[model samples]
Target: MAFTGRDKKWLKGPRAVALLAAGAAVVLGLATGGTVTQAAPAKPKPTHMQVQLLALNDFHGNLAPNPATSSSGNVNGTPAGGAEFLATKLEQLRAAAKAQGQETATVAAGDLIGASPLLSAAFHDEPTIEAMNEMGLDATSVGNHEFDEGYKELLRMQKGGCLDDGDGQNNQNSCPDPKSRFKGADFDYLSANVFYENTEKTLLAPYTVKKFKDGQKVAFIGMTLENTPNIVTKSGVEGLAFKDEVDTANALVPKLRKEGIEAIVVLLHEGGLPADPRAFNSCPGISGPITDIAKNLDPAIDTIISGHTHQAYNCSINDPAGKPRLVTSASSFGKIVTEVRLSIDLATKDVDRLNTLANNHIVTRDVPKDRQLTELITKYQKLVAPIESKVIGHITTPTVVRTADDAGESPLGNLIADAQLADTSTVTNGKTPVVAFMNPGGIRSDLVATGGAVTFGSAFTVQPFNNYLVSMDMTGTQIKALLEQQFSGVNQAANKVLQVAGITYTYNPAAAPGSKVVAGSIKIAGQPLVDGTTYRIVTNNFLSDGGDGFPAFTTATDKFFGGLDIDAFASYLSAHDPYTPGPTDRISITS
Candidate 1:
């Protein structure tokens, strides 16, 4: 739902304009004594409604730009993103639409909050919700990261209130704003497919209907990936059922049509991957789950705004009826915005499908920052400054990034795994961890350094889930089974190779999915793995409970819970003084 600043029907309509006394043109050629008179301009009545939807996705509370070294800091080699620039871009896009007599709504496909920078996540993302309000965001879908903190917290994000746990524990300083209370999202968070298992009620409103000036209506249905439960922590999605994305949206199409809303758009939080030569505005080739999902979608859906793959692509994948329907995604971290325009027939009350247009716009920083957003950011910067600027450690000149090599290992991933192992091995309460396994998905951002200095805030942004470390005992045979799960069963479609601190293994990427790991390639501490020997392994709770399609950890024994992963990382960084990116050679690849 794009937010039109005012009720568009009231702007310049016949009912709102004053009729001239003369009604038509007045002439100075009077019969006797003539007086010059001018007639008011005739207001042209618009024949149809032009609706513009300005959209963004996967913002992830990026109030500021990434460090120059971080890939997410910019787009297409140009400095882009940051809330100030994003707000300016949105305003510019909306203004352009308004000048054309088009109504506009700013929408998002979700990931607006959750794993955010310290400035936003420090106060439970209240600042982001406030920032969105100022940016005139009308609606967004509920993404998987929105559930990182649990559903109750997500409800709090929508309904607005003060969190009872504002004691500055676990990186949370909720409701620390001067107002002392959060007002929640001014925008709607549509959750069409997510529901409560008990009563079968949707977690949030299923869809939002936007009515235009000419009495035409459009519906925006939002949904996350159906496999959200498998990716998120169990407690976050506890008692909530995520139905198939296709079925949930299809069920709502007829419901909307019955109410005379034929122009439908889906703000789906799932997306596809663009093939080689991926450009921000056009797709050379497209494949992934979204390609199939879009094909199965009902023809009644006019447009689809997608995210979660964090890739930028604009395309028109065909609907079931074989007519091309617009499908678009703006890349993550507020770097891009998609402007979708549709011409709705005044007589038919539906979209002129052939006349629809869509494109992705990069939020370049050349424009002046929006004043309101600047003020909001400056205020939060002051509040978060103390914690954000505290130098906790130093890093090498070249930063350690989250980019993984062909063998599925990253320098940042290895660093985090080492930190976990270091944290667990020093504990006196349980057996020292023989290996530390980190699911690649948990490594959020890169370890970028400014002047070779890394701060607590930067670390928080890198690992913001605040997931606790859990250690469990398993035999070498069980460990082998766990490693196999990375490229088999649930992970075959999208494998997640674990980063390790105490082991090295080789695998054949082109081999059959279930047999990728080379025989006897796994080794722990330079020793060949023995099937009967027991070993202690450490990982975050999300992975231990099988998050990100890795479920083998569920059967381990003697689990030991430790402190926060962020703490371990920060401590490790400080203890090491000048941290360097790991060799990233823990995992090997065989042709």
Candidate 2:
């Protein structure tokens, strides 16, 4: 049905007619000398119901306010983000929708935990889950980060208790209270496309049906990108298989429709980037995998809420039947929340596509902090103070930032690569790694020294993934292939450049993808790399297992797992106090 600007007329039902007749009788009695009486008119049954969906995505557990310098934490150049502020905004939005006679549900597109800030990650992300439960999250799809600790650990997150293995190394089991236990998330975690290899069944509930008091039902189908295994650590998805997003979603649509659930919303963890960076609320020329997925979705699906790319945009995409459907995403780190309004037709039990609208609202820091969230943060902060405040080392200058250059090299990346190289230089097997590489995505933040001293929290924030350094042997030719892989195949669109140490190379960006690196340019300490010569290389486990589309590492031999990446970096900083930023001459790019 088409959305019109004209106000809908409310028709009186049988109950209202009966009430008016009763009132008329009273009026007649009053005219016949009986005392006059007044009766209130019966409230009319609404012909259609408005459902308000408050959606957020990629909230990587920033319970406390993020630093002002953090790009993701800012909204419209204002210091924003923090669970407290996010909670207040959600409450306000819910209240406003309620006032307008609309039912509201707060949902997320996932990445609610994993790779979180020091406060939440210190305790294995339990604090973040607890905070989300308090904020009244109704449901969320499983993002790739949810599989960071592996599927078993993900199950523990859903059905909670203390981590059975008790991560003694990182003190992940160090609860705020000695007797405290982590209570699982109160909301449902749906994963429609992920299936068990053994049983050939979905890993989690395919979808959840939300029923309103007025008999309006909407089905929420949740799933991550089908290529989850390629992005996450291989072990995390050992026994699981991710099916095609379009196929899985289309297959479920008929079942939901047969069950009388006409209104459907897909909570997808995969998202797209908007063409215009400034258009946070409007989708003008949006492009990415989400665009193709939305176009192929069944017409029965009403809206799609997505994440993973961590960009924001609200758009109306056409379904297979050429029907418009709302698709939206809120930027990462709880900085923005997308409010979607849907008008469901009572007779058809389907969304009135024309009447649907969505907008992204910033979670501004100007609002009052939520008291309960404040208390939660305070509790966790106090418990984490000792670890967070411990001095890790010192930085000689503030210029050592995480910002990558055109060639993908950065001072901080160089430092991390150096640290990994040093840590793997002398392993238990006595094999030394001659070169090291770090993924750009792993370097989460910059080493901004506060008064020249770097705190443990700062170090942890820089390398928050907790990936282990893996040393392996690869031929010089494979190493060159690895560099070329950065610009081709899966990396072509993402362009995930690798950070290097103990090696240097020059490349021409204008050259063909597989032939970007100049011949005879790859070198180690001024010596040209020989094609057949084998060399030991060190990198994080994520990359060693072919994560981030770096498949060249998967062919390496003589695997040796070393210390945690953060520890190696911290140790390097501690040993090299007053450390200066390294040169960014590792990778030279020529047009």
Candidate 3:
């Protein structure tokens, strides 16, 4: 079953015999002094093919290099990640593979755009799309963030065009280049699990088959996490139903096999975490949704490239038949690239699973930058320069950061919640919101005290979703149900504890999910929350629409849409100059 170059002659026996016969015929014709013609022998079949798969995930439209202190950090103390450097690294990888007669493909697991930084977000992620196209990405899965602007916008991102109804006066020119209308993604975006609710058909292509020069084919099936709708803005996924990831991938396996594509790879938007956070290349004590999904995958699948948790790990998980299958992920923000080498046996037309090798490579900054990518970054940087450097506010202490505690309470989260509460306190309807809740996911980054001053870009980076505040009325019982829901159902795995303002409660982690929160412990403004009484609540529109698995918010009454979350946060910071960290006593965790 193992193939080495020396055994290639056995697989090419028939072709060699045909070539020998042709040579004998030519010799006989020359001996007779008569012109004779014979058909040329067919090209010899390769005994094996080597394919290099270069993958990254959760890029999040970081066209420029992120600061070492931020999301893009040193891998073993080496500064890493910049699109220019990433392009260079990818080219180097492909060149090395080519020298050994191998083919290379650049792919992604998803979140290439949306929730992006100011540079790329300014033009609605057109720049990021262009950057990927330039870098020669072959395909990518659709992450939840890809649905942030709704399916129609996602279609635009794929098909190429400008936003017809641009985002306010500020975004009048949605397309970055006026000389050319936006050209859509050169790479294919796969989404096997997402289907239109009415038609029951896939919204996009389920999978894509890539063929090598020697006719060896590999199919890539892409899908996001099954609970995508729960985390994304409800309106974005209103007409779509996200099916189970494993079921979707399994269903496609037979179809691909029927097409004679024995090599299958899954580009999934869900990922796992390893025991040691620093071990990027080794999988030790790996655990998460991806672990279970990988183990249950059909034996036909050769590899699983994943993302979404934004952690890096290269694991060899066994499939259902107990065959080892490679599963890998690259850290987020273009910080790393996962290079997977798959050996395909031409004889069986399937992957030589035993010979596959995978590892995570850092996109170190020491490499020379790609000049084109550098120019692209410079173009976007100049466009966002005005708003990127404006001084907005100040952080008095470094501890006023986004790092959450055991109960998921963070100084920045508390501050953001308080800002939303204050913004909705005096609405035109005369109904005031007494409590505010911020989803931990919505807090993208920490408010690092750089020289004690925070820029407009820094504030925007912390709250980049462009979410609007929505105030509503919920009963104390519903509020309690929401708190309890955080530790159960779809959320139980991640345990996304909501950040609270003007509310406090203790929860026991050892208790059952439904009974985690201590009864009679919930209080707001020194008063015990009465089960029958109603309280005004304010949260981002995503949460109000029951995002993050908080279904209780869907039943809220008297909903009122307020200002943008970032604006409220900025106004709050402006009012409280030199802000200090708040007490983390809001949500206490009990064992």
Candidate 4:
């Protein structure tokens, strides 16, 4: 059923201090006025319950300020992000909320562990989780990228595992103990709809209930995209299935309600926030999914924190009951923190009918760094310092990370795709790479041109994720099918075709929606591509698993080694020095 919107009850009542002390006393089996009982104080109806939810998403383990943007923007519009500065910001936010006499819960929308800078990736995501624990994050929803290493590795990261250092030793020299590979987090990981196929129950708990002062209880439900199986390595989630978000929430809410939890929030790894609402610049109508989800979700759901497509928007829409449901998403990369204050009535013990607030704070690094978080990050930072600061490759031209309206493809993306295709082709003994496609979303940052000198550090900053290269054999018709997926909707977001190497195609925007690619529109090495001919193509593991809805790559045969795709791109850049894009070298799409 289509989602229908409703009016929300805006916050309007006078500010009142929460009776958290009373709530705590009740939980502790103490008396406030009448009697001390063993019956949990009859749920101890709260007089007032105020909660502060601090959220961040897509922090791809950027422990240090990327040298690429050092010359320009800083975290808080200052210089750049250093652990010290970011720690300070997180701590300040938490402390300030506490000072205001409000309970706080720090959370994230995932993409925090995988594709991380060298420090965490090298150690198999431990460093990042440890850093997160230090930052006081309470819970997180899994992002697609979190499954980068597949499910077994994700489990290892969660329950701890072992690593080798090429010395054939049982453990890496740094971590002699197997248990040291992944130090588990202090917070919870929620995945409501994801489950083992046979059981049909959540692979993980659907949500976690957190208790606070004045007997106030809150529930958090987590969900990734329903098509997670399509975007994750088949082996990673071998026996798992991802159910629809709405269905998942509908099933779980009743369970939480039964547990005496009335206030509920959803931390979904999906997204809808756009960089510019009016401009619709890169991803137009990016908020579609999140908005639709919010409108249709049961009224029991009070708020939704989202991520994945890293645009930021702060607004509130209503549920089916005409009661306001607050929705907030902070800008990615630790650049912003979304703070939501949910006020509950002291008398009714329900969400305050007239006074709840949603605030999206831009986490500027301009503030003093938090010492506690800084110190914790430093322990890992020192161990990761050498690798994080190392130079791996260089770029001569700007590399052109993004493709504009009139533009056909991006050089940086082409370089990465070509590297993957070439790398796999050679390793497989001269297997011709007919085409290579790289999802635009995989290229995290733009290939920035720093007037004078350029280094590998800059390149790492541009392509930070650890997706690997996988080659598949597909017919030309399948390739066309893939292209169609990128341009399906008229007012779609991120519509640009995935950038490619070793092939080119023209798309007709004026044509009817489904018939965009005209006859003979696609080419391979300047020759018309025959629909029936089988061709070997190369794409990152992310797409091979159908990320961003590019399912064609998953249909390919003959997949190969699964090493980091970014490393391959870096190698290509290193091998080809003085890189430059000619007028028509990378891509050309005509009207």
Candidate 5:
């Protein structure tokens, strides 16, 4: 089993390297008569590689601490999310690895930008990009949200385009100009499967080869969900098409193999395992697209870093070849960072030992904030501080936001729907404003009255996406159909709703199928809701695109942009007194 110089050379690639390394270890074992000679057991093969990797995803531009629940649904953590803390952590980890004489790499699985907090989104992800640059990310995959501003905007971020003239339009300096400080991103982007429809070739490099000082080679392929087009706004990715992740990897592996590259990793803009719902500490029970992709990936891929669902976990699964495949994900909003250590056989260059070291650490005041990166964040934070604190309105009562179990609507959801409805009606020439509905998933956080001061920033923290308020007139029959979408059933069980502004309905899960709505509870302003009558409604553009399967909104007539929903919500709160709903009657799906 001993490997000759020629054997080691042949096993240089990542795939065959592991086998060769194993073969050499076997030979060494036999030669030593199953026992190692003196000399401290020859220092044994390293259980981990000298390379340390830190990965994160789904930050959602939460430049401030976000209120997140524990996986186990108990206890509250400290104020833990911000660019300063994230940078601090990344630097600390990198410094530790460097002290150990190992190379460190920081990367993201995407969602590094869009649908961000008021500070980042308002600037069209420039601030987020600046933050990521300071954080030292090496590369990332293009997540669905990256398409929020359309392909041109994506190109702008990638190629360093700007609005140097201080105008928002793409008038001048759209791509690259000689005078601007826009040097583009310090890292690269991978898009193995995404392609231009008109051209079959990949729109971005399928993979990037990273070489370490030890002559070890690692190739990374980045991919987003294959259904990105369906999930994001259509115009955002007009000329692009996404291909299957596994297929793309399979096709690219041979090329890497031919080039003598062995170690391969996937930076997938997908996700896995929820953090312990019972405890906020660690992740458990792997799930989602990443699991499926890992299970089906070619054996050549050694590890997968995933995001999107915003949960954190460290585990390994079996690939199609029956070899162990490692996968890890960090929780969303900079709440956690995953460190994956891979050990490869030096002689054969194949992965032998791989393990996940940590997850779900609070990025709090405890960590030593990196002064350099903190300065960068501080500059932008100061620039947006005034706008973020500008008061929008106030709520007398606490507004709760809950999407646990993906069940019924939350009070915050109701606020968002009302905002959309109010805004839409106010803008349209003669549109009726009967009622509005917001999906619970759209409401990101709860707002406490806390002395009755609410700001524009706080409102954005509730509904941050740039989704325009949309209005439509739907028949009562359509409303009933929308209710059915949230009904649990054998085939369609994942259903939940958010509260509405003016519309009210009751759901009785105990009732027979198709009869869950209470007989007389469906109403609008004390009127018996006629099944055939049309009523004006408001919702976000995401729901209008049939997100979360609320297809009824898509069928409604008279759709138009009603401006920012948060503004309307602010106006509604200003006009109303105290703003308290009757009860938690938004949804009660009984057992």
Candidate 6:
């Protein structure tokens, strides 16, 4: 028997199928019907809202395109990155999101300025700060480089003020426009972990709560590595305390929840390395401090935007609750932007973590340039031309590059270390230096020599820190300990192998952590290093003060301050008129 109209209304949904199989004829309302009934499909109800987070990190103020042939200028074989192109790409991304009815926020993970090219650095990175404001950066974390000049200068970058030192302190100009002076960043600089010890308060705002049209709030908590003091100049973060990333973020979750906010984001300045280096969108075997930090983060945090390693990758890391969460980093220097589309649960006001998707888009130069950024770059170029155009020296074919080889040594890194050694050796900085060790991270860019002629601009771009030289005396044993640091301690997860001159050694990376260096393989000018022998070492003040986790450097004796690093580099280039690439044989890896 078939069911009648009234019977159909009493039937269940998909659950009705079970009733039908149980025996339909048992109670057919005492009448035979002509047809059987089927359930109509249920209409879908919206459960989430799309929010667009356009992120860029480690944009070390490349206001103009790097030299065409330089690695920094290219991304994945495409001529990419320049402030104009980056601005246009961001505009397109924001416009696309707007067309789709998505709420959008532009954010960065840090290193937005400092170590910039001549155009931006000449004005104390004010142009880059202006550019970031123009591009609409909503907020950013403070990277190690943000403290390059000192926390006071960083505050000035965020709060707008002219340097009291005026125009000539470090070959940089004061505010170009005296009338307007300098307008600080329109974006918020979140520094959750950086606090002034004496005051017991953050140096900047700890986090920013972004409120959208519907009143749904998203909290972005930002912080740099706890090891900041070890990486930045001691003078920069003198009274600031850097807290642990996970602990700091986790502590904020309860506070955010107290305010009924559930969707949370972290703009962390720490980063990781991907096993598959070439793929920006895929993170295979991603490992580093960020991984460990993500693993222990509070489950309430929905996303993590990381930087500092300057490598690109889109990844999904598991939170404390074992739920997959989105993690991303765009390669540095404004070369790429990681577009993250997060779905917020409308009912709960929390992120639908599973519904998130991220992509790292290259800032390809094919698109039309943003006029405003172009004008900014042009104005700065004109201001810096007089001094930047001065020819410093010449370089042979195949200019020295900063790209570290398999052994973690770069031709430019070697050149810089040698230059530092040469400077102190002749000038006699109280202690005559026999060895110079340069921190690889300090070698920012390639010394691109067009027509074999090196200009002050090109040289400055490679070493913009203006870090002065320090000559010190270290026992041979202390020197060995410093080399071991390349693969141990905070560096164990990611290497910071020093670039050296007047030294040769083979390291066995596969060996035990502290025993990577081969026995008796070390030599300084073809002589074995004696444990008790004292040797003079020259390095930039950053390294000499243990800036990169080499505590051994801090243990050295009789520090003698010398000229600026750039001065040594420029003078070396001039003295060596036609600088040639080294044999590049100083470092080696054991089989």
TM-score, each model? 0.71, 0.72, 0.70, 0.67, 0.68, 0.71
Ranking by TM-score: 2, 6, 1, 3, 5, 4
lDDT of 4 by residue, 1-591 (tens): 111121011111111111111112111111112121112211312466678788878777666555435321243334545555666677776786687677888888777766566655655667667777778888888776677767666665556556555421211123423444556767777788887787867766678877888788888888877866554455666788888888788777788778877888899888775434322111223346776787778888877888876555554455667554556666556666676667766555556523455445555656877666566556665655444444444456655555533545665666666677667422454566667888877677776646523444466666766556666678988888887877775324546567777777676766665577767767887888888988878777668877777777677776653446766666676676556643435454456
Q: How many residue pairs clash in each candidate?
A: 3, 0, 0, 13, 14, 0
What candidate 2 gets wrong by more than 4 Å, as runs, is 1-46, 164-169, 389-414, 421-455, 461-499, 505-522, 525-591
Candidate 2 lDDT tens digits, 1-591: 221222011111110000011112111111111222323421223666778899999997888887766576687687878999999999998897787778898899989987677788777788999999999999999998888778988887888877654533444544557777887889999999999996769888888989986788999999887877755556678899899999999999989989999999999999987766556755556778998998898888888999988787766666777655677899989998888777788888888765555667789989999999999999988888767777778888964798988888999999999999888423645678889999998888788788899988888878876666778899998998899999999988777889999899988888988999889889986789998999989899879979889899999987765556887898899889989996799999877
Whichever of 1 and 4 has more lDDT, that candidate is 1
Comparing 3 and 5 on TM-score, the stronger one? 3
Could you tell me which residue pairs clash in candidate 6?
none
For each candidate in the order shown, give its overall lDDT on alpha carbons.
0.79, 0.79, 0.79, 0.63, 0.64, 0.80
Kindly report which residue pairs in candidate 2 clash with one another.
none
Q: List the residue pairs that clash in candidate 1.
A: 2-105, 2-106, 3-105
Name the better of 1 and 4 by TM-score: 1
Best by TM-score: 2
In the range 153-258, model 3's lDDT, one tens digit per residue, is 8988889987754432343247645577888999999999999996769888888999997789999998877787655556677889899999889988888888
Output the number of the lDDT-best candidate: 6
**Alpha carbon deviation, residue 65, candidate 3 (Å):** 1.7
